[model samples]
Target: METLEAADMTQLLMESHELSTMINQSREVSDYLSAKRQMEADVEAQRLLALFEKKKEQYEDVQRFGKYHPDYNHISKEVRELKRTIELLDSVQAFKRAEDSLDELLYQVSRTIANAVSGTIKVPSNNPFLEAQSSGCGTGGSCGCSVKKPS
Candidate 1:
């Protein structure tokens, strides 16, 4: 009986030691998981911050120079080429006209404004063209509508 009791105590002690070791290992695993999660969150935050910075820079550039806007790329390119051509030209008036390049811009702006006035944003008054009963410059006056005058 004494030998059996000794053997039982030894077995219990071994089991207790194993249980404590498992508990310690579980704690370590928990710590490791927590660290990994925090690292992932930190990496995600940094990624978002970088994305925000890039977008902010683009926004600032667009605000500072209107040509940087996404919608202005093609028009801006055309304008730049036009300016270069005008610079090469020997005539000053031609250069001025190219530099102004106001026709297309004016048309687009006017069309957008007209659409807004007619649909989304209401204006106090209608456009003169809308009020006019006849088309084709009825008064025989220079009613500039998509005119491309040569300088």
Candidate 2:
């Protein structure tokens, strides 16, 4: 019976360890998804940047001409193009931030799940996680953890 008990403990520990590994692997998947999303967003961003760079000289020319010829029409279009580029860049930044937030949230959730399974942490009551440790009774008597308490 002692051997059987040891085997059960070994199996439980192995399963917990595997679950931890899977959680870590899923975090990597989130990272990969973020990278792919960023790559797609970059295309539009770079196009806008390129437009700004390519037209800068033209805009500068119109600015210099409009100083002498106050009724210049080309200057207005150049200004509008600059605004369009700004809007595109802003859109890219927003997409990147959304992707980053998704990755961060996924990582936090995976870590929480991994800790719950392997750390033997007692789950908090509904609506009580905020103050869970405030009324602690120390470690519960039957903590699944096998670690010895400090002497």
Candidate 3:
């Protein structure tokens, strides 16, 4: 039984590696990489991204220590505006779309694998992955949906 389990694990790993390779070679991934490179090379985008990161860090720090800072609201607004502006860029928009596509692909693959392992598991027909992608509520937090616990 141990040897059989080992063989099954090895097979699963090999298949997972193949799937990863396929995902990497996909157009969405290629586009995402290209857009990322372009964004990195843009001076203005870099400046905006740096500013956003700095403000985000400050906000997180304030929240973490349970301190009320008068600048919190201002920082939050600035972050949102910066993000909106960044998203308006063609390269950034392309990167976002590619990222969402890749995310959905990965989520679907994971769900399929889980369902295969546990035949009793059933996912609703609403395409939760795509819904989450579109809603832009990644992983968790205020999505009005219960978070799934890992088994």
Candidate 4:
């Protein structure tokens, strides 16, 4: 029985790796990679991103001292403006959309795997919509909720 269980575990791991390979070859991953490459190759994007990071650091430092900081509002505005400018870049926009698409695909895969194990199993995701559903004590019996355990 132990040997059979071990064999099953090995098979499951192999199949999971195959699934991973398939995911890596997916259109979402391809688009993500292409967008990332384009974003990296964009000289303007790189320059703006660097500037954005510098402004963000300044903003963080000012934020640490709260409203009392002399340059708080100015630095904050600069950061926001830089973020807006970065977002407006075509390469940045494409990369962001591709990233979100890949994230959604991974989230769906995780949810499917978790659901196969148990409907109540929580599937973590960066999506705000999915997060709203998982907000409470996840119905997994371990949470000490009034929800009944799956049979």
The Cα error of candidate 4 at residue 104, in Å, is 0.7
lDDT of 4 by residue, 80-129 (tens): 88889999999999999999999999988887777676766666778877
Off by over 4 Å in 2: 1-41, 67-71, 85-151
Give the clashing residue pairs of candidate 4, or none: none
Clashes of 1: 0
Q: What is the lDDT of candidate 1?
A: 0.46
lDDT per residue for candidate 1 within 19-121, as digits (tens), equals: 6576445644455455445544565444544555565555555656686567556545554555454344334333334333433333334445555444322
Best-matching candidate per TM-score: 4
Off by over 4 Å in 4: 1-7, 133-136, 139-151
Global lDDT of each model? 0.46, 0.57, 0.69, 0.84
Candidates sorted by TM-score, descending order? Answer: 4, 3, 2, 1
* RMSD list, candidates in order: 32.5, 15.3, 7.3, 4.2
TM-score for each candidate, following the candidate numbering: 0.19, 0.29, 0.65, 0.83
**Model 1 — TM-score against the truth?**
0.19
Name the runs in model 3 displaced over 4 angstroms. 1-7, 61-68, 119-151
Worst 10 residues of 1 by lDDT: 130-139
